[model samples]
Target: MKYLTIFSLLAFITLFSSSCDNDFNINDDWADITVVYGLLDPAADTNWIRVQRAYLGEAAASASYGEPDSVYYDTTAISVYLEAYSRGADGSLGTPVNTIFLKPDFTSRKLDDGIYSTDDFRLYRTTETIEEDKTYKLVVEKSNAKHPEASSITEIVGIQQSSNSGFRFVLPNPNVIAARTFNGNLKWYQSDQAEIYEVDVYFYYKEVNRQTGAVEHLVQKLDYTTIEGAQIPADPFETIDVDGSPNNIYTLLASNLPELKPNTLRFFKSFTVIIWAGGEDLAKYIDLNRPTEGVNNSKPEFPDIENGTGLFSSRTSIMLDEVAMSQQMATTYYLSSTLCEKGFAIVTSGDTCYCERIPGIGPERVCD
Candidate 1:
């Protein structure tokens, strides 16, 4: 499910325009420049690629942006396909495994309303499963032979079970007591072809309105940590670690969550962990295109597709849900003197003990 917005496409145009001439020109010689953006994910049921043409005409670029002909090719005008190749012992591409022809998709996914035409929003797609161990090459050929075919090769970010590098939560185990002083390493195995990783943690809870007896489920997310440009180890099963502290979770909750209302009772539900991995090429593209500061505002181009502009890479994400803390840890933290002030409670043996504050008085526990 990789797609691009009109703004990204415009940025690509700007990047190519800058590389071609010192001064911006609205009326340059007509050239056939294909724009392609795709990210292969082994976990996805279907993969999609966005293909479009960059236009430079005598008239203003913005004036023609709304015209379908200016940004998109006719369905029959181009053919898109993916070639699979296995890597040899020497790291060279082996014989072709298979070729996957992509069909033009016009209606599965909709585009947001913008300056660009949406009448026939197009994307090329294939339902074939992408293999994590194989290399993929995307090729786009135009009916007009004068235009050179655009192509790019990438390796899929491998985190599937078959790859023997499936992501797993190593620390803060389901039964671990996550006390306030708990300090451990949040760890997971690195995937092949992955260079960048991002982890997010979600905290789920239920809030009950004491006055109305209404319950509301709530969740808060924390961008726990990120590992960028990690060099892949010779061993594909290498594990990576980041600081994991229970105090950090408490601090994040205190800072982001709203203070409890006088008549509210909150109960801790569970936690969820999500990790995202980006392929090496995608990481390089992101690094090269990131904004620069000071007098050097120009950025280096990162178009991977030959004879065209835009990115073609790989990315994948995994989620571990229903992560739980030991009952002792849950009560020690959620019902502690500090967090209890925020109307936290615990349910045990069909009974509930919640914190309550009376007017002109300190906090007290009320059991029901």
Candidate 2:
């Protein structure tokens, strides 16, 4: 999920506000200047939109946003909404398919108070299905204001699936023993509108009670590896590279599982691969918010919103779960000299031996 913390951005703006003092000159009349943030994704059942007012001056800027109600708006005073536009049967643009109000929902949020806020941050939410090949716009308005305080638009271009749809497994090749080690790459074809990609592997396993000789299925889902915020330029047609090293995979299991105990036994289960991707707006938002490239120390202006500040974007993720280990590889967890040395527990189900780790992998079982 994308976090839209304005306190940090406010602090950052404060740091550079002096240099660009004239850009944010506060009027004595205290006319409201709104700050908005939201990232839309069809994959999510509930979408969130965060709205806050921009503050200025040394004293207000330095104040911790963690304090209750310091950086949020009154639900009665503000209204947030979303509009979806899609093409019709004729393939020509038509009227908005839907216009929905984002309802208020409050939950404890760790925000940036120059550090980060830990209070309940208020947000507007909707269950609208943000569809593919559609355009979405967000509008925020104050009850007393004549016009929307903030507004932004984003295009929802769906992510293009790879030939294998991002989950490709490297099964044990009959001729290559080494094939038993490597878990193939998690790959995807980039969307024409996507600019950032993330890949991760989840290894799931179980722990056992040696004393009772009872099995505890689904103990942990270890994040074996992650490739975060990878930049992909040009048309995203070719396959993308994700970590697929066997050594690292073993190391992760060994480190998490640790030394075997007489009181416990663990078993290896299935593994999952996930690919998270973001659209062009998210990429631009990242570039604008990510640390500066050089010593220049200036911040880039955010461009998506109009007559206001912050971001409006879209994202999506794909997952492949319960991928089974090759028989050769599963067997090695117990009998292979190389894998046995890693401290993985050897457990038996009937007559078959499977490797297990502890602390453990997310409580999801890997198939034997």
In terms of TM-score, how similar is model 2 to the real structure?
0.65
TM-score of 1: 0.78
lDDT of 2 at 137: 78
Q: Using Cα atoms with residue i matched to residue i, what is each candidate's TM-score against the true structure?
A: 0.78, 0.65
C-alpha local distance difference test of each model: 0.79, 0.63
* Top candidate when judged by TM-score against the true structure: 1
Task: Report the lDDT tens digits of candidate 2 across residue range 294-347.
Answer: 779888677777767888888777666656675555655443333554334544
**111: Cα error in model 1, Å:** 2.1
* Alpha carbon lDDT at 186, candidate 2: 45
Candidate 1's C-alpha lDDT? 0.79
